[model samples]
Target: MKQPTLPFWQVWNVSFGFLGVQLGFALQNANVSRVLSDLGADLHSLSLFWLAAPVMGLLVQPIVGAASDRTWNRLGRRKPFILGGAIAAALGMFLMPNASIFVAFLAPMIFGGMMLALMDGAFNVTMQPFRALVSDMVPNEQRTLGYSIQALLINIGAVIGSILPFVFTNVIGLDNTAPKGEVAQTVTWAFYVGGTALLGTVLWTCFRTKEYSPDDYNRYKNIAPKIVEKLSLTTKLANFWKLFINMPKTMRQLALVQFFSWFSLFIMWVYTGPAITQYIWGVEAKWFDAEFLHSVDVIPADIAAAKGAAGDWVGITFAAYSLFAAIFSVFIARIANRFGRKITYSLSLLAGGIGYISFMLFQNAEVVHVNLLLTEIDIPQGALNLLLPMVGVGIAWAAILAMPYAILSGSLPADKTGVYMGIFNFTIAAPQIVSGLVAGQILKYAFDNQAIYIIALAGVSMILGAIAVYFVQDNSDSTPDERAIQGH
Candidate 1:
């Protein structure tokens, strides 16, 4: 039996949770480094601290996915995982920045790291199921549209989350700085708002959307299992390895591109805070580093001011990119229809690469003079440089979130969709892990401790990803049954 196609609003209802989830994620993404730095983490160890997120994602997603597959309760198949993850994530968001206040026994950085891991793991739990849910409900023909809706919502949330700190500091007159080791009032309030949004949106989806029963889902997929054998933990672990060994050619090809894409993104996320602090603000942020703070003679007041400025600009940059992503998402479907998905995605990535590269052009303390409509406006070259690149990042981000999964959805077995989506997360997680491990060392030795160079590396990596996409065989045009057997 053909799965009934959902109307746009129904699709909207099901995917709307991503908005809040991504809001929580975006807030974390944009501000975690700032929070950690404020709590006294070193630039060299920043990536190591961020390792918590990807490591948790690597372990959590597949387990959550497999569990959701076999689960059947009054709450529905995927909704339980979704709701559970959201609740944990909400708690995590609230605790992450405020770890110093809440978990005062542990060092602020250590406590924040634990909360980061918790939040990231919970996000993976929520994220994997939602991706699989889209595949489960939307027919192959509408998969792109469904995922695009998700992309659109994700960007929308990101925009709000990324801008919150800036808004709080600038608009609402919240304090963006705190005493030596506490988080800023701006960050604390942002996390509180983000946590609330995350839970509320997820609850809306849980109440508004319904899922096919497990047996009914199997029937719809045209898979008839003679036995309902329960899977043991041992069996599940073995199956994950088996699935990895037997991954489809398309997935293998996409994996290469995903590696480069996420590696660059990981670098950006890890280094951007320090880069802005050091390069744009013209202040060393080493007061957060215990060793450096003890060894060097620097005033605490200067260090706090620099960190605050960097955090505010980073928030603004993220907001700019998210805004661009949301705006670009409006027309992405139309563009993809006119041009092939591969071409569109590749071009979008290439644009982002150029945008990232532009950052290198600005000199420290240089003013960017803009002449718009006979008005002369002077913007900091460092901050203005980020805005244009965000357009490209935004475009590429929209495609990255939607295109790969939309192609893979048809090729996956219907009953195993959750597992495969969980498995696919390995690609995203592995790159981040690899980058996290090596990024600090690379910056220390190769880049001469210059954080800005990491963005350059990210730009090149994105360009490489754009080239890699053409090699993948897009299976978006094929039906599930037709493509499922073909890939295997």
Candidate 2:
């Protein structure tokens, strides 16, 4: 029997938790490097420090996915992992920015890195199950729409989380600068709010949506139920290895595309703040270090203020891209249906590549004014120009979040959805891990430690991803016409 078609609200409820998840992630992506820099990490070692996130994801997701596939309890199959991960992630968020307070025992950077690992591990545990849960619930025809809605919520959350630091600093009048070896109040408070948001939305999804029972799931997927058997730990490990070795063709083909895409993204996350600050605002990496600032003969207030402002602007730029992504998500299903997922995805990645390449062209820091109802706000012309490129990045991001999963869901066995989804995360994590390991060395040796050149390299990687998209075979049964109809 075919799975029942879920109503729009039910589909919305299923993915609502991602809003909070992305919120926490947005804060981490936009600000973690900046935080590490504040606590004394140099520009060259920033990506190495960021190795915590992808490393944790690489280790955690597959295990969580396989475990969740076999799990069923009073709270439901995926919900237990989701709720538990959210709680752990929330605690990590609360503590990570405050690592300086625990300096009596461990160095702040070491403690912060541990928290980063915990948060990312928890995020991977929570995220892998959500991907499977959508496949488990949504019917074949509606899968695109379901994932598109998930993308929308993810980008929406990202927008808010990305901007929180800027809002706290500019609107709420919080101190954006901190003493040596500490995080800014604006960033710390943003994490607190993000943690709360993460827990609240996850609870909503946990309470509002229900998972299918084993027998019902079997029926819906048109498969026979197998007898439950207790297996040895050795046997389980062997089974997991078999699954990895025998993953679907489509999954393997998509891995190359994911590698380039995520590699570029990892670079952007690690280098964007430093890149824009040095290239546009004339703020040097050394200015971000409190110890360096303290050791200077005369502390330049203007340089310090410029560094803080540049960091806040990085948050705003991240928010702009997320906003653009959210807007593009509204039409991703339709666009993919009209052009076919391959063409649509390729074109989107191409757009993002062009956007990243354009980063080097606009270096004007001339101030521009926007008149509010009661007052005026001034922003750098170059910063405002950066938003135009984000449009392309946003388009790519919308497709990246939705299309591959929509395509892959059709090829997966129903009972193995969780494990496969978890394994798929390897593609995402592996590239980031590689990028983290080498990006710093490339920046230091290849580009003379100028972060802007790394952004251009990311663009080249994205274009390669655009080209790689043509190799994947989409096995979904629904035609573009059917997808368009369902999307509407």
Candidate 3:
């Protein structure tokens, strides 16, 4: 079968929806901490607040993938779902900052999270096919460039999303304070912008992008639409159970690695900010004195003036790592092509592991003041140089974004693309579930609520995840042609 031709720009347009998808993800990642903290939730309970996110993903992703497998529209099968999810995300983003209290807050948070899940599911509807588009469009040799382009877009969107808050409170002069723990006007504005951007950008992809119709896609294989005629809960369960039981052996072995890897990350993301503040910066002493509690999410917000050059530096640090990914994604792709996906994965995990562990070495209870280790002095939060740490995370992030899919897609039976893509996502979600349940519990009992140690464990798990990669034997030689002949 001749591969269909695709221009480089077409790939960009098709991936334009990622502009919005990544906007939502980056905002969610960078801001969720500050939001939960502001809403009177304790540090330990933050994981619980975040729990709703993964739970929704666990419930929504596979079903969405399965449904979209049969769906078709004038725009496209995946496009309709993508549009719907964007609307859901936009609506939820607008509503997120309006929560009144603890339990009540979880209501909007969970509802909002469900919207994200739906949006994410919708994105997945297109995601696999979009990759298939790359596969279909690019020759075997150019596949690295194809994936590199996608990685570039992923990080560019992330860079923009991560810096928006700093732009709002510091530069835009939006009110950053609310009396008695109310959500800040600046945060509300950020959501509004996020909602608007999320929809507007998704719509950009919907119009600018084009997908292979069934006729085009069927050229490579005699693909028939596997429509789910049944819609009841029992029927859904029955279908899912069947798929679960019958998952490919390669996937079965790989899920364990995914489970551990994501769990470690979830723990890191949920706890890192608070850990840095309480255990590292000891910002409590500054704030509890009622003299100077900083409102900056990553560092204390300076009250007297707008952001100085320092805040911009934080944005630079965050974005620089992403830039590193953009540069390195192609390098990783070439390495994977030469060395195999599992080896590239092992190296990535080791990089992240070393990155996380590096924090422990810098866990000084004192900062130099007046050229002395003064007991009576405290340093500002941003004073810690996080450049190396962010770079380490970038390596992990690059691996998380790429290698698993490269290995999975090459090995999976092409006909099962949608189902298996959905299954692969479970690896990302399950870890979030484990982290929300276990990290806080471990923090309390084992480490006396020191969240930094969880990162050490995360580092170790990632290293173990690296080691586990050896277990995934590549079967790229087993092609779609072979699978059909074997009645797979």
Top-TM-score structure, candidate number: 2
Candidate 2 ranges with C-alpha deviation above 4 Å: 288-299, 371-376, 480-488
**Model 2 C-alpha lDDT per residue in residues 226-245, reported as the tens digit of each score:** 88889999998999999999
lDDT of 1 at 445: 81
Q: lDDT (0-100) at residue 351 of candidate 1?
A: 82
Q: Which residue pairs clash in candidate 1?
A: none
For every candidate, C-alpha RMSD to the true structure in Å: 3.6, 2.6, 6.6
lDDT of 3 by residue, 1-488 (tens): 65555677876776676766767666666666555555445556677767776776676667666666666679776677677777776776776666544345355445444544444454444454445444544544455556667776777777776667656755677765544345667667777887788788778977887666776666654465565465888987887788878887778778877876788777766766555655555444233211122343433453211222222233444565566666667588666656656667778877877877776765554444422121122344333555577777777777777666665666655555666677777877888888888777787678766766877888888778778877876554334543343233
lDDT of 1: 0.82
* Clashing residue pair totals per candidate (backbone < 3 A): 0, 0, 1
Clashes of 1: 0
Give the TM-score ranking, best first: 2, 1, 3
Model 2 residue 170 CA deviation (Å) reads: 1.1
Clash number for candidate 3: 1
**Model 3 weakest 10-residue run by lDDT:** 303-312
